[model samples]
Target: MFKLGSKSDADILKSISPSMKVLSSREAKLILRVMDECIHQIEIVSFFPSLLENPEPFTKSLGENLLRTLKEHQELEERHKCLVLDGSHDQTNSQVALSAKAVQDSFRKIVRILRGTAEALRSKETQCAEDIVKMRDGLCELREIVLERLLTSPGEEKQLREMVLEVSQSHAANQVLIDSLEKDLAMAVKDKDEEQLRSTLQQKEKALQEFVGRTQQDAEKQTHSDQKTSEGKRARLQQEASQLNSQINNLIAANREAEVELRKKKYKEETEIENVIQKYDVEMGEKQTELEEMIKMHETDQTELRELEELYDVLDVEYSQIMEERQKAQELKELQEKELEIQSKAATVIQALWRGFCTRKALKSSAKSKKAKKGKGKKKK
Candidate 1:
């Protein structure tokens, strides 16, 4: 098998210059087609052939094909990476190259894991097939012995019938349990309850394992009972039972692996949902705090408005009182002006009366003096 090299496409592409344009669409499509073919080749190599009578050659062939395909895939990825790196001129081109390198690395890792798992499965299946063949041979020999015994005895046939009946009853009981578990699994899936589904699957798997173990134990007991009569028959039966037990164990392992994968997927989804819920809760908490702050601000604004209204009311009353005082002052000034005008008119009238009286007195005095002078002159004559 060709081993994958540690050096990746990123390491190789790092040495390339970053002054060239990206790859053309046609070249990119060709690289994608090569990748598709590589994937197809890997899938083909992983598939088990129907004619697996002898699995060694088939396993070897599968391994060789897988290794060859992996090598080709690695080479194709390297070429694609080179082409991408050669095309990287700008930031976008560089990002595309890096993305391609990452995808190639992840693909290589997946292919390697697939190869390993395929090899392990092949080895396990090959051993199981061999054991099945051995069991079939043993069964055939037992059948011959049974046929010979049946020809002589009839009581043994009754016991075989009873054993078959008991096995059938046990199978039926196991089937019923399996069906119930399947229903529960279906319900859990329908509800999208990952934890419940995982638990149910676990229970189902455990039940199946337990049932297989019980059947194996019963077979061993039966073989032990048969050992008292025939050692060779008991040994053959024990071998057959062991092969069946191995097959059951392999199936259980496969089921467990599938369940584990499902559990991982469910866990991932649950974690994502929880993260989303947590984010929503955080956002809600922030919004609630913001709302509370807004409410508090609104209340503060209301209180300020009330205080301003009260202040405005007090100012309005003071303005009205000042207006009333100004009106009273204007009225008083008008009354004072009227009183001054009345007093000035009265003084002018009194002065005019006094002057008239003085003129009359002067005229009377002049007349009396003229009479006195005329009498004196008559006496003298």
Candidate 2:
């Protein structure tokens, strides 16, 4: 067992250099503490072999204690690494380095000892395996011996160790079986954990898929609503178009009626004019005859001339009234034409509105159908 001291690596470094002499006491104390820890670890490593060679009832705890010691040494290594890298560069640095190296060397030595222990464990395992096999074979032999003794002086046989060894072998085999069962149980537990995780993941994925499907369904429903809205709009537009068509037909019929009425009035006016012209020509002919007769009787009639002037005044009044009626008819015809033009423009606007609305409805219906199909596909999947 190597013992740590002030005279170990630390004290020597502290005494040799001015830069490190300022804190020799602290370094010496730390060196002693580190050495004591190393010594304790070495004892644990050394004691493990003895315990493995002849296992005590407390061998499990002894092995745990040995591992604890190894962990302590590892912790020391980490701490040393941190401290060394923390700019602790003094003349004491070499001494600290030496002490850390010593600790590392001790760990290597312990590893070597553990390896020997591992070999010893391997030997023990081989012996156990051999013993197990031998015990099994010996059980058969013992059974045969027991039967033989029963056939020949059965009560005289004294081979109790054979029976005990057979029982022990059975126990050992049972222990091996129990160990294997425990291992399998542990593996089964691990597999169950993994399976649980897998099932959870699958459940999450299923939920996600369900959510997506539901979203798709919602989209389809919205599309359907939009389609219905669009269809309703189209229906309204169609109704309006139908109404507009009715109005157009009515306008056309009204226009036709107006035109026919205008033609009839024109024909009546033309007939009236022809009647007036014929009357005027007949009157002129008669007047010329009367005038020729009057000339023949020139000596007799001033009163007759006065009566003719009054008749002429009445004809002039009738002519003025006819001219005013003609002017009114022409104004009415212009107004009817303007009304027809306005109706034509209105009909065109209604037709365009109807077409646009129909197109929108068709697009909406198609989109709805596609969305519904997609929703159905997801359901199938």
Candidate 3:
């Protein structure tokens, strides 16, 4: 039964041969129309590495293969152009027409192969770009790890930790999206929905590609901004350090000068103090000599005072003896004056008695004579 089915299919193909030949000719023309497009796509794919900062080996190898294919395609195009030019000369020959048709058929096949190769190269280019982005992400992660190890500031370390956590979350989200897209693709394949399957696949791939591109662009922008900021901070810090060093140098110079001046002042003060002490010592020596002379003079004056006191006592005794002698002489003179007065009064009394006695003697003598005579005269009287 299978053989019969196969035989019937072959018979049906034989009946369609003429129509298929016509269709093939039309397809040939169509292929010609698309040939330039395929070549342009190949060219675009071959040039893709130019946009990359660091292309991988796979991309380089694929680009080389694309270049080789493009060169072959160009050679084939040149041959086709030559054949078209020669077609006029062979216009009368059926054999030449058959050969030309065969050549066209071969060119169509080659064009198809080049188109497939170009598509493959384009897919590879996209994949290469994705891989490069992944590698850059890995390097960034490593850099973060190294920075975490080297970082001392708590704020910067915390910022880096948060960034790492965010990157991890984003990666997880991407993984979940990929898994969901893959499941949808599996479901589409199981249902044999070619259109839906193709569209879903294209959408997923485009979304993923766009997401990767956006991620790369954002990362690059952030890295560039961070680099600019770090450079500015470093320059400012260097300027501040320079200023501080200059200020420190100035302060050190000032301190040294102040120390020198202090030392000079201290020495001058010490010298002045020593001179004052020496002057005081000289005055003290002079005062000590004067005190010693005053003490000697005081001792001599004390001895003279003792001698004067003795002389005063002797003079007092002599004055008392002279006063006693004066009293005795005055008593002697008063007694002599009284004796002289007594002698004078006795002499006057003696003289008066003598005169009376003499008178009495004379009178008696005369009375006796007169008695003799007056007995006669009798009294002569």
Candidate 2 CA-lDDT value: 0.66
lDDT of each: 0.66, 0.66, 0.66
Query: Comparing 1 and 2 by TM-score, which wins?
Result: 1
Assess every candidate by TM-score: 0.24, 0.20, 0.25
Worst 10 residues of 2 by lDDT: 151-160
Writing each residue's lDDT as its tens digit, candidate 1 over 160-227 gives 45555655776677778889999999997888887778899999999999999999999999988887
Q: For model 2, state the Cα shift of residue 145 in Å.
A: 99
Report the C-alpha lDDT of model 2 over 279-378, residue by residue, as the tens digit. 9999999999999998877744566666676877787787778878887888888888999999999999999999999999999999999999999999
Candidate 1 clashes between residue pairs 3 or more apart in a chain or in different chains: 21-87
Steric clash pairs (candidate 3): 377-380
Candidate 2 C-alpha error for residue 54, in Å: 99
Location of the lowest summed lDDT over 10 successive residues in candidate 1: 12-21
After superposing candidate 1 on the true structure, give the runs of residues whose Cα lies further than 4 Å from its correct spot: 1-288, 367-381
What lDDT does candidate 1 reach at residue 338? 90
